[model samples]
Target: MPKSKVRKKTVYTPPSSDRTTTPVKLAGPTHPVYIAVMLGMMLIGLAWLVVNYLAGNSIPFMATLGPWNFLIGFSLIVIGLLMTMRWR
Candidate 1:
């Protein structure tokens, strides 16, 4: 019986030596209205904190949330930051 020959496997690769990069087309909110909305949110968060500090019970909803004031405020700021990142 004839001896069987082993076959070598080759992996496929890109022809270009340089690494390929896909163009990232990020859709950013360039609309002035949208930017204003984000700014409003950030300002609202700040105002809420300040009001809670200066005038107690000024913001009824803040009391309802209890210690989450920081959470809410920071979340609003973070959202604004995210919007800024996407803003063109």
Candidate 2:
């Protein structure tokens, strides 16, 4: 009887040059309190408009100013949103 020969398989190794050393960083604002305060101010302004409307009372100087408060409130909200997207 003849003896059979065995064969071994070759293993694969990754190169060290393909590895990454730096960590990934996120992009955005880090101050939550400022954003919260801006949002709160906007909400308060909106609430004032609603309350005055329901009470059938004309907002002070609204007739002359022409929706100034609403515009200011909306601007505040937009600023808050922008600040939230900024990096700290």
Candidate 3:
């Protein structure tokens, strides 16, 4: 009598986890808060630009700040933009 050979198959098993993949949480300002801050900065920059444009020398304080007045306004905008990057 010839004995029949039988093939054995192994089943694949997946890893067990309590939870599935989830999105990574970012640490920073919320959307609305970030937007508000950004907008405020933009408005301030705009106001500074306007004030300086209108009065080139009348603002005595500007004379003390020198070229920093322009820098301050531009810096605010830059900071806002940087902050926006952190927004989630």
The Cα local distance difference test for each model comes to 0.79, 0.63, 0.80
Per-candidate count of clashing residue pairs (backbone under 3 Å): 0, 1, 0
When sorted by TM-score, best at the front, the candidate numbers are: 3, 1, 2
lDDT of 1 by residue, 1-88 (tens): 9999999999988698688888999885589998898899888888767776776356677678777877887788778877887667
C-alpha TM-score for every candidate? 0.58, 0.43, 0.59
Candidate 2 C-alpha lDDT tens digits along 1-88:
9989888978887666966779878666657787577667667667755654564246556555555756765676666566655536
Q: What lDDT tens digits, residue by residue, belong to model 3 across residues 25-47?
A: 86764778668988899788878
Pitting candidate 1 against candidate 2, the one with the higher lDDT is 1
Clashing pairs in 1: none
**Runs off by more than 4 Å, candidate 1:** 1-29, 58-60
**What is the RMSD of candidate 3?**
6.9
Model 3: CA > 4 A from native: 1-31
List ranges where model 2 is wrong by over 4 Å.
1-11, 18-20, 23-32, 51-57, 84-88
**lDDT ranking of the models:** 3, 1, 2
Lowest lDDT 10-residue stretch of candidate 2? 51-60
**84, model 2: CA deviation in Å?**
4.1
